[model samples]
Target chain A: MPLPTLAESAIIVGAEADDWRAAVRLAGRALFESGATLPGYSDEMIRMIDEHGPYVVIAPGLALAHARPGPDVLADGLAVVTLATPVVFGHPHNDPVSVVLGLAIKSAETHLETVAELANVFNDSSAISRLTTAASVAEIQEILGNAS
Target chain B: MKIVAICGSGIGSSGILKVNAERVLKRLELEADVTAAHLSSLSSDAADAQVILTSAEFVDAIGPTNADVIVIENYFDTEELARKLEAALG
Candidate 1:
């Protein structure tokens, strides 16, 4: 199945965050604003990073923030936040993530499928840069395979 | 062969790892059943797997396993995954 449809409201462009925690929190806030997760879900995402190190920096300049399937997830949704200034997450290879994706998954299977789908988009290194430099929400939506 | 991609929750980064591994494996002209799983289910999910793919952060947490646990540097970098996977299973 296709990844959760990202709403326009959930997209934040040219967002400013002081650090990785704030950057991730912004993505979680987008998820919350999009009606995909509860307000506390952002903290859970932060907690995961605090516990596990910066493995969430899956690729150069990219970070996908999320937690396990939990009650906080109201729906399977994805949020995108482009940082105006990148922040380091202490990753050895991939550091200073500018793109933070907050994902709220209601189930393990479907969310995994979405990841596969998302990989197709993120696999292109240019697309990742575009996301970081995107000035408009529509550009991000387009880059992420969302027309709207 | 069986491969497992593991993460804290198994849904986010691990899922990305699983997909990237499948792509690399296909490019390498190799076939393996790859699954994404959480750290909690490592024992059962990766029991029979020949290789386990994950980031360095989880290496200690993975503990001891018969399978070779490969610490992936970048989940989206096919170059890194291809090099490591080819070196491991070439």
Candidate 2:
């Protein structure tokens, strides 16, 4: 499960603003509007974020938000967003997040391997840059393909 | 060693906690079979586990866990958690 396999270019965006909540909402919009999500996904995602405060900030600017798959996951896939400017989600040590990775797994088990792959991906400096600057979906896919 | 991670649902945060716990145990050079399950099924699961790791909310979620419950605020802090688990198991 490479990042691009789960990441779609259509969802990527460049941000110039500073509000992190808006950034999350921006990512949420991509998830919802792209028809990449199941019904009620946007609300569930917002609720989960409001409660958890970006629980999966794997590194400084990288955050992965995943909610339980009840009625939110339209497919057995994922939706992603790369922030144009970094925004803070109120994490204790790390303040700003530049890339928001939203995942909707149809089943709890479907994401295990992807999560493991993400763990390794988040550890690299160069790889994160490639993903952060990825301008198109094919480029994003290429990043994942080259990550190995 | 058999380890059981009990949480509200068998699949959400508890599942991530289970993954971190396994990573910690592995780092500590301990061999253990780990499983994450909902609080509702604790009795059967607790019967075989050598160690039980859970959050502070155990009191409300499933009454009191019968095994040595290691209360942790966040499961992702592997270093502190590994140390806590080592002490509990020791």
Candidate 3:
């Protein structure tokens, strides 16, 4: 099955997040609000980072925060949160991320298409730049819609 | 040659690395098969790869392998990756 696109309700523009944890929370909140994930999903993401490291900061200015699929994931979901001020993930590379893309997958094998599409979007420098400056959820949706 | 990109989950950051690696390989005129796998699966998945590219954090987790492991500081920079691939594959 094809992965879902960036939901309008799951897009947070100009979000106020003081640190990476707050940024991830803002992104995870969108997923929860959209009924894609259960509560505590955000905390789990942070915990994973703390245990593993900052590998989630996939690109120079972007992060794709996620935890393992479990009861917390109601369905496969994607959320995008653009921070008003970029926060550092303490990564030697890809620090001070301005956008966080939260993902909730039902299973690892089921979300390859979604992750591939997301990687394509992120690989495009212009798309990442536009996403960073996107003013509203509608704008972000339009950008993603156009990409698809 | 076979190459694999690895990450903690294999679906997230490693996917990005895999894409970048493909681009770099194409530009370098190198012929290789590239795959992405989770850190947990690297022991089995990386056994056949000639090279394994991933973040520095996973170097120790990957342990000792026959493949030449390259620690990429930046996954987004395909130019640097191309250079490194040339150096490794040439």
Candidate 4:
């Protein structure tokens, strides 16, 4: 299966959040508002980071936050939150993350394609730049489309 | 040589590491196969690999193996990954 396009409702541009947790919560709220996942899904993401580390800061200025699939996820979903101000994840190499992509997948078996696609998107320097300053959901979607 | 990039889940950060690893190998003109795996699923069988790259948090989980486990603090820094890979594979 190919990676699904991020839903417009799940994209939050210029989100205001003082820290990484609040930024994650804002992204989680988008997923929740879209009925993609249950409440507290964002908290679960934070829990994973707290327990382990900032491994989710996959790239410089980018974080792909997620947790295991369970009751928290109603369906496979993705959310993009571009912060007005960057927040630090305390990752040695990748700090001050400005883009947080929230993922809520139904299962591990079904997430390979989406994850692969996301990796491809994040790997592109130009795409990352566009996403960092994307003014609207449409612009973000266009960037994803171009990358795909 | 075979290299595997491990993360909490095979699909996420590991994927990023794998791509960066591939780029590093290509730039160095080194011919090797690189793959990604979940930290929980990695085992002694991975001893066949030349190197195993992952975050520092997972080093203990990887345990003892014939393969050299390189703890990468950042998965996205291809330059750092290349530097480390050269030092190891050379």
Candidate 5:
């Protein structure tokens, strides 16, 4: 199935989050509102972060926050949040994340194929660069349209 | 084989590591089950992982684990680092 766009995922921005943690919280909220998260979703996601760091920095500006497909999801869906300014997750290769993609899957198996496909799309620099500069939901959606 | 790719956040750089490892593993004809995890969460899952892969900065976190730890740059380019991982696994 086709997933949501960056704008659809980016429900919170600089105005909402003072830092990356707050931004992740905001993204978590968006995911919850979209019916993607169950109870203890944030805790599991936070656990992943606490254990790992911000591991999903795809490019200079993009970060995809994901966890194991166990506790964080109420349903199977994906959420995205874009930052007005980059936020750091402390990953050495790229920090200051501008885009965050929240993924929640009902089962670990269901997520593998989609995540592998998403990884391929995210690997494209041109698509990532356009997403980084997009200023509005529509623009971001348009970028995803091209990328997807 | 089940391969666990680890990184600091398990978000940014590890994603690349996962992709690159998948590519190399594919080429090597290794039927692999690869997943990416943050270094913090690595402990619980490390017992069954055939190989533990990550980047240079976070290498210390692997600490005495049974899995062999291989560190590379965060980006997807694999020529140099892939060789290192291949050697270690052998």
Candidate 6:
């Protein structure tokens, strides 16, 4: 199945998250509320960051918060939260992320497929800035073209 | 040569890095096998790889590796990938 779009993926715009963990939690909240994942998924996402450093901060202003495939992930889905105030993940360069994208995949195979498809959305250098300022889920969908 | 893209979890944007690396390699007129892998399994997944592409934050975690570890700041930036790949493997 294709990844959920902004409508079903629980895209939260201009959300309030004071810290990186809170930011990931906001995204995870979206995923949970969307019926895409279990409640403990957010804590897992945070733990990944804690154990592996802030490597999830994939881009200058983006954080692809995720954990390995597990029972916590109800389905292959995604969630996004735009922080009202950007949070830092302690990465030297990609710190102060504005967008926290929660990704839950059932398997590594589909995981690859999802990211390959998402490559188009992220390829646009301005995607981060646009997503950061998008007013609503519709605007987010617009910014993230080829939304499924 | 084989290249492995490392991320916190293999089942995430490492796929993006893997695909984008293929695109960059093709544009540079180079060739290699690329795979997405989790950082924790660096020993097995990257055992026979010649190059390892990953984010800066994961570099130190990689510890010691025979392969050339390249830091990619932006997995979506093909231009940066092209430049870095050219500089390293040109």
Which candidate comes out best when scored by TM-score? 1
The model with the greater DockQ, 3 or 5, is 3
Give the per-residue lDDT digits (tens) of candidate 3, residues B1-90.
Answer: 999998887776787778778877887788899898888888788988999998877888889888888888766777778888888888
Best by lDDT: 1
State residue B69's C-alpha deviation in candidate 1, in Å: 1.6
Model 6 C-alpha lDDT per residue in residues B40-75, reported as the tens digit of each score: 788899999989999887888898889889998877
Error of 4 at A82 (Å): 0.6
lDDT per residue for candidate 4 within B1-90, as digits (tens), equals 999888776656776677778878999999988877776668743658989998877787788788888877656566778889999999
| Selected candidate, larger TM-score, 1 vs 5 | 1
Model 5 chain A worst lDDT window (10 residues)? A7-16
Please write out the lDDT profile of model 6 over residues A1-148, one tens digit for every residue.
2445556458888988778988989888999998889989999999998988888888889989999999999888888889888998998778789998998887787676678767877888999999988888888877766354
**Model 4: docking quality category:** acceptable
Measured with C-alpha atoms, the lDDT of residue A129 in candidate 1 is 91
Instruction: Give me candidate 1's interface root-mean-square deviation.
Output: 1.0
Cα lDDT, all candidates:
0.89, 0.62, 0.82, 0.80, 0.64, 0.85
Q: Give the per-residue lDDT digits (tens) of candidate 2, residues B25-73.
A: 7888888888776566788887877777765546454555556777655
Q: Which regions of candidate 3 deviate over 4 angstroms?
A: A1-3, A146-148, B26-29
Model 5 RMSD vs true structure: 4.3
Model 2, backbone clash pairs (residues 3+ apart or across chains), number = 3
- Per-residue lDDT of model 2, residues A3-82, tens digit only: 42444533675655467656656666666665667546656766665754454454556665656667666764445677
Ranking 1 against 2 by TM-score, winner:
1
Worst 10 residues of 4 chain A by lDDT: A119-128
Residue A132's lDDT within candidate 5 is 65
Name the DockQ score for candidate 5: 0.27
TM-score, each model?
Answer: 0.96, 0.65, 0.89, 0.82, 0.71, 0.95
Local error of candidate 4 at residue B18 (angstroms): 3.2
Error of 5 at B76 (Å): 5.0
Tell me which residue pairs clash in candidate 2.
Answer: A9-A137, A15-A84, A38-A74
